[model samples]
Target: MSQTPLQEIELYAFASNSAQFHLTPHEFDVDLGGTVYVSTPIERNELALGAEAAKSALELKLPQTCDLVRHLLANALTGDTTAITLRIARRDPWGDTWWIAGTRWMGRVLGVEVADDGARVRCESAQVSLKRIGLRRLYSRTCSHVLYSAACGASPISASAIVSGSTGRSVDLDGGVPGSVSGGLAGGWLQTPEGARHMIVSETGSGVELLYPATIEPGTEVLLTAGCDHSTATCASRFGNLDNYGGFPAIPSKNPFSTGVF
Candidate 1:
């Protein structure tokens, strides 16, 4: 009896926030037990290894029209790398039979770029996080904790009525019904249900202007987050979470270290 030739195939899988995609450039569709890796125009370059002090990097290239490109752009632009996960696995096929060869690489996405009819994804190994410098205590007045972060513990997000209309960068929220408060969303964010986030540049009459051009449609439910100047007063009056304020409101205007007792 003749033995069937065995072939090895590499598979790529990307997942984030419940959306998962299995892809490969080797075959039309790869089936590993139950999960199928749909073939696509995906390819990756050789992993680059750097010195012990330098971080290793992996770059993946995909067509610009691929759906993965848009997903990558959204995640990268939103700075939500923690939600993105990638894994590369190997499998061997001998005729109709196949077996798993285990995972070859896995890590969080670092960044993405699109150009020349293609998109590139840059990823770093998990160990690279260990190279991060530890945060030192700050005595300055500004808050050290990031807003909405666990350390900050402030939830300013509020769902408003469906959008009434959009003109230029200004979007009419709550059908132009001015909430009881004015300038509630200034210097904050306007987020669409589809996860598109835009910065609120200025609060206009019954609407807020965005920093970017508006594509949001009428009747689209949106979320508005009140902004914070990271001051104790705003923390108390706005979010009503003064207990979690991270800024020092009593810092002396003049630096005592720079100005000695006269």
Candidate 2:
């Protein structure tokens, strides 16, 4: 079939383990390169040889109203590797919808630059080969229960976890499962009624502080999930989901003194 001509582009960012977002950019530029060989004296006028590896980079100038830029900044501050998808779309002559070609890659936010002219935000990122890296835990294991929210196929709570009180930075919750909600769920999420998600930083008694302050009204219905510290016992006992555990619980904690110098 004949393909339609290119018409538009769409960018999406999935950061901090949340849902995807459609990001609008005022200026978007991409650099695509490949590793090639060329010697100065011998092949000065000739093109480089065939490529062995590929490299890609993206730079965007976006409006300050775009929240994805802030999300990218937060990810940068927290050392998160988030995946970004860029779609090249073509207007289908036969229909109203556009046909899209997508390139998905994991990348880090290299920098976030601000301009004095109006409220424009600029950022740079480079492609990451996530598949090339082997599977490993990003953080050390803890004994807390793991959190699997609705986005991860965990069932929704019937009762409202939100209560009618807040300290502008913290929220009090009610109607949580007796043993399910606790301090162990510190890093989990609480999805608000407006579909915005906030991360739980620390929990004490009935109050929970978010990583960043959020504007949530009183009596709003919210959903809460537990957070896991990636321990074997918590996986098996608390969540009963040990089959999916990927950590080495039996690994030695001390180095092997094979030389016997001590």
Candidate 3:
């Protein structure tokens, strides 16, 4: 069948950019990029800059029963929600294939509010984050860098381990599981070759609790990274990279400048 020309479809791409939820304010499913965005009741506010607009915030009202809402609810409480982002893009059929004609809003998923009518997905503009940042880093007790990230240096987490067991939302480590409080795998993460990553919430001798609901097969190979409490002690002792710690732990608790009583 021939598709509508220059459809005003909005696509929400999330889940590490692996999943796409195609939606249109229109009453029919529109095929773009060879994917079908089913028809749904959507209310999106205008995206613009000026005094009278919610410039930095984008809100989408979607049915509570929709797949995207269910997906957000499942991963919202369990995992690091920041990695899950929502991109609002308008697309059109470009002759042979579809193209992202324009992007109205793109940013990290801030939160979701559910009501009897629908679920509201709130997102902050990607630029808003840059505006809040200062020229220099702030003082803190822990390292500011993310684990296994480029700024964390090429520092790698623990070695890969064969899955000894699996559960609906957890995994049995090949060896004893250390809790996050104890500077173990709890605050770290596990990654598969297929690019599936689950952050460890807490760990015990039994297994590691992951943020997502998916389970790993017993024979699947997974990589486990050690967690950091971001304390100076953990930096010196565990990773032995205290020099790279982001926070200024030595900052005095009482600010003499404010007190005028140093």
C-alpha local distance difference test of each model: 0.66, 0.49, 0.63
lDDT of 1 by residue, 32-105 (tens): 77888778887776654434312455678888657676666555333344323334444334356446665556
lDDT of 1 at 183: 58
Give model 2's TM-score versus the native structure: 0.49
Better of 1 and 2 by lDDT: 1
Top-TM-score structure, candidate number: 3
Q: Which stretches of candidate 1 lie above 4 Å from their native place?
A: 1-30, 37-46, 49-55, 58-93, 96-104, 109-123, 131-146, 157-159, 166-217, 229-237, 240-243, 246-262
Sort by TM-score, top down from the best? 3, 1, 2
The residue-by-residue lDDT of candidate 3 on 56-122, one tens digit each, is: 5777798866767755654442333533233344543454444566455557676766665778888
For this target, which candidate reaches the highest lDDT against the unseen true structure? Answer: 1
What's the candidate order when arranged by decreasing lDDT? 1, 3, 2
